[model samples]
Target: MTNERSLSQKWADFRATKAQLFWTGIGCAVATMVVGFTWGGWTTGGSAQLAAAQAGTTARQELAAAICVDRFNAGGDATAQLATLREMSTWERGKFIAGGGWVAMPEMMGKTDVAATSCAAQLVATPAPQAASTAAP
Candidate 1:
């Protein structure tokens, strides 16, 4: 009877050990899944932010290019038109335009008559210095 009782105790201990191991494995699996989900969320968020930033940049560049083109069409001197184009550099125009080119945004793809007329007016108006100089001469 003593030997039989000892064997039963051993069996109970072995069963307890197995249960503990099973729970431990489940915990590890849960941890791995959480980590994977967190990583995926972070990557997706970063990509979305990057895309938005690129879109903004492109819009600004398109606006600037439209202005510059309008100025050129209005009979403004080449120098002023060039100056306007150069001013666009502060907004990183090249990168902005390039981004738009890649994404093909609707705003970048279409043109309006209003913008053309405004640019023409802006470009044709004599720059203040040029007007003064011409008056002086």
Candidate 2:
């Protein structure tokens, strides 16, 4: 009976130390996570997935814009179209390109908005090719 009582007393005395150790472990785990995520470049699964999706969207838009530029330049009246495109306001250029069906690639069917805007910017920035003079200098 006495031994049992002593064992119980020892357990009671050690309870505070046990609780402190548990809390310390929890705090260490939280701190490690914070440091890892903030400075160690650790990303959660959802964040990685979101980043991948954004990258794919950006790549698709870029490809569509490139194809749109090629199609625009291949047209018979590219100079005239470029003149008209330049005359429009910046905000209207995207809609103009979309309406012209420059971004109608099969893979880019429903995703023309970003591609149109990018194509318009590229077209406006690029200078039209000069026509060769027939008269020899």
Candidate 3:
């Protein structure tokens, strides 16, 4: 009978220890989650910065291409423009050109022709003086 009594007390103590450990684990998990949520703004900011950087790069590249295409359309010679674009390192060309591909990057979205036509029209309206000078001679 005494042995049975001692065995029961041991079981009770073991159960208490298990319960305490379980609650401790739960508390630690909750604390970690709170800290994660409170201090995780850097991730969001980093993503936004990365997105802005990609957009800026795309805008600059698109603008350059538009200017080149403008020059090409003006005189019907894209050789210089193509050469210039091609001379860029493969990585730069890929980053700047449409199909050469910066689009696949997670930070880069798609392209739009939002300003292309208007810009082309403006370029067409204003012709270079060199052509007129050559014709005069």
Candidate 1: which stretches are off by over 4 Å? 1-43, 76-137
Q: Write the per-residue lDDT of candidate 3 for residues 58-102, one digit (tens) a residue.
A: 686466546645544554444443455545654444334344321
Residues 22-128 of candidate 2 have per-residue lDDT tens digits of 99999999999999999999999999999999999899999999999999999998899999999999999999999999888787667889999999999999976
Error of 2 at 35 (Å): 0.6
RMSD of each: 11.9, 7.8, 14.0
Candidate 1 has a TM-score of 0.28
Candidate 1, residues 1-137, lDDT tens digits: the string is 36455777887776457889999999999988788778745356888899899888656655755655543445445565445544664334334323323223356445333333334444434453444355554
Best by TM-score: 2
Minimum summed lDDT over a 10-residue window in model 1 is located at 96-105
| Number of the predicted model whose lDDT against the real structure is largest | 2
Q: Could you tell me the lDDT of residue 134 within candidate 2?
A: 100
Per-prediction TM-score: 0.28, 0.79, 0.29
For residue 102, give model 3's deviation from the true position in Å.
21
